[model samples]
Target: MANQGPKSQTILVVGGGIAGVTAAIEAAETGYDVILLERGPALGGRVAQLNRYFPKLCHPTCGLEINFQRIRKLKNLRVVTMASVAGVKGEKGDYTVSVSVSPRYVNANCTACGACAEATDMEVDSPFNYGLSKTKAAYLPHEHAFPMRYVVAPSAIGTPEADKIKAACKYDAVDLEDKGEDFEVNCGAVIWATGWEPYDPEKLESYNYNLSADIVSNVQMERLANHDGPTGGKIVRPSNGEPVKKVAMIQCAGSRDLNHLPYCSRICCLGSLKHAVYVREQYEDAQVDIYYIDLRAHDKLEAFYQRVAADPQVNFVKSKPASIRIDEEGRPVLCGENTITRELYEAPYDLVVLATGMKPAASEGYVPDIAMEQDEYGFLVPSVEGDGGIIPAGVASGPLDVSMSVQSATAAALKAIQAVGPKS
Candidate 1:
């Protein structure tokens, strides 16, 4: 019998977040052809939106920049932004993947020049900031956007503003008629690293997320502390632009509840703790209160929990907030039972940060019809048989922090390489 093996050794990585980026780089550096796809206009995913991570509290962009540099230097790797997986077919070591690309309207001719932005008077809510701010219709994705190209919003298409944007570009980078294209690639293995999204706080009706702009989600808190964010790094009330004096961080806002995720997201506790640090660093007199069903700072993170607990200004309350109400003065008031004291309490704060948990991006329903299996929570599950056909990495496999996501990506890369490598 003739040998039937992988026709191509190329590996395809879907989702250009830290996980996808790491897998692509690791595989390409190991001398394998890799293609990285991102659904957005750029490569960086949720990690790019963060102010800083826990423990070290180090800036995310610094690490992303290094990875970006590695990507730029690797000739065996190709990055396709504004692209998504449409479908997948075939078996391990031999697969055909279909991809759909969205038009950026701006092409490789772009020089990161601000001329295109200066031309458009129309604006759109910036998704990078999670709609906390607006950007020009012809705008770059973010400050650290990989490829560093501008994008023309679809709303600007066929409008006079689009013409103005096209005319303003000196490099002819703007292509007003550029409709995106769909294509297929034959590869040996696939790595799924689509990452995650923040749980919608609006669904937590009792939290009254829409009742007051002063109430924000944990992801918004990250932007509130980011220098590139809406308030320019000021931890202020979104309603009136005033500094927050009294702050409340509610843990497990949408997780570990039968009505919601019903699983511990594992990052909420530490995230809220880091948020406490951001508040204290900005305002010394600020008093921050954390309310949780229970603190789950498991394993190595206990030290961080202990350090934050030591702060005299940061108080830990043993309770789960039942609802949030607005006062006559339009302030957000927390109403709930204090489990420790076994007493009902209502407390008003200048701002409330809901520690909303992570929801797998695959849950949004864009995943291709493939052999992968998703848990009830919507996280992709790797094959237990270790066929190495379709691998799940990073947050797509489960809820994981940045460091762990990288580790997951590395493992996925190795599995993909092994699956595609020449067999004896």
Candidate 2:
């Protein structure tokens, strides 16, 4: 019989977000061969969609660029995009993992020269922008994509536009007949870093999210504030191209309720605070009202809350809004009782931003049916006795900010290395 023990020192890092990328880098730098897989056409998951981080509010690209540079210099690390784990067989330190690779239709010959995008007039909702904007059928994932490769949308396949896109590429990089294939990776350890997704605002029935275009989710608000977003960094009424003077930011839109996410998302409060800053910086006369059940800012982040609270134009209401109703004039009105004041209040706003929470990717059926366990919230949980080589990192383990996710990834890397290292 073959020994079911540390036969290979290779580590497989799943998901290409900041957490997975960090784990791959840390493990590879420690002399372990690492295979990093991303389910999208390019790397940079949810972090790539954000406008900026909280508190310091620095651009996310700054850190991602440094990681990208490190990846280019590392010879032991290999990155495979448009791939996901299908299954796993065998025990810890001697596992064979089945993998599925989706067709990007654009091959390695891609120079990202923007020729294909220009050749096709077909447009599709851009997933990078959370569908807030439209992109050409043949387009790059984002400006800072690590591989810097373009993707041909499945919607464009089987159409005459596909031929145009292929013919326009000078290097003949577009592969119209390219079909995805499945393979297997032999590794001693696995790191699951699949991140979180925004809680759907449409689930909040009383919010009237579907009835009005002015009611936007927290993630959508990020895109709206982004320079490459649909509105060109201008916060406006999505119903019409009018500037927003009065904005209502609702905290815990789909979180901390019996019907929705029962636990605090940890980042919604800070995100909403950052959104307030985005509005206050753009429009001089903008009045921002922040409605919340309670603020969850703690530790070093308390100072950022204080800074935004100091703005006289920003108002904080200690209330959980009951519902949003549109008036005959098409204005959104908020109705709720103030827990502190014990009085009912009704207010109107040009735009309502719902601060949605994070839902683990595992909850959405993205995780494979492996030996790994999950908590009640569907976040991956490590075995109590440390019996397996599969480890969870970043938001895959729990809800965390960018800084916390990096810390989790670093710890996971150490654990993975120990799993495949020489047994003491």
Every candidate's lDDT: 0.91, 0.90
Give the C-alpha lDDT of model 1: 0.91
User: Please, what are the lDDT tens digits per residue for candidate 1 over residues 1-424?
Assistant: 1222457788899999999999999998988889999999998799999999998899999999999999999988999999998888887778888898988999999998889999888999988888888999999898879989999999999999999999999999999989999998888889999999999999999999999999999999999999999999999999999889999999999999989989999999999999999999999899999999999988999999999999999999999899999999899999999998899999999999999999999998576546578889999986465466788999999989888999999999998888887532
Give candidate 1's error at residue 143 in angstroms. Answer: 0.7
Task: Give per-residue lDDT, candidate 1, residue 169.
Answer: 95
At residue 115, candidate 2 shows an lDDT of 98
Q: Clash totals for all models, in order?
A: 0, 0
Error of 1 at 319 (Å): 0.8
Clash pairs for candidate 1: none
Which residue segments of model 1 deviate by more than 4 Å? 1-6, 384-386
Name every residue pair that clashes in candidate 2: none
Q: lDDT of model 1 at residue 240?
A: 95
* Lowest-sum lDDT 10-residue window in model 1: 1-10
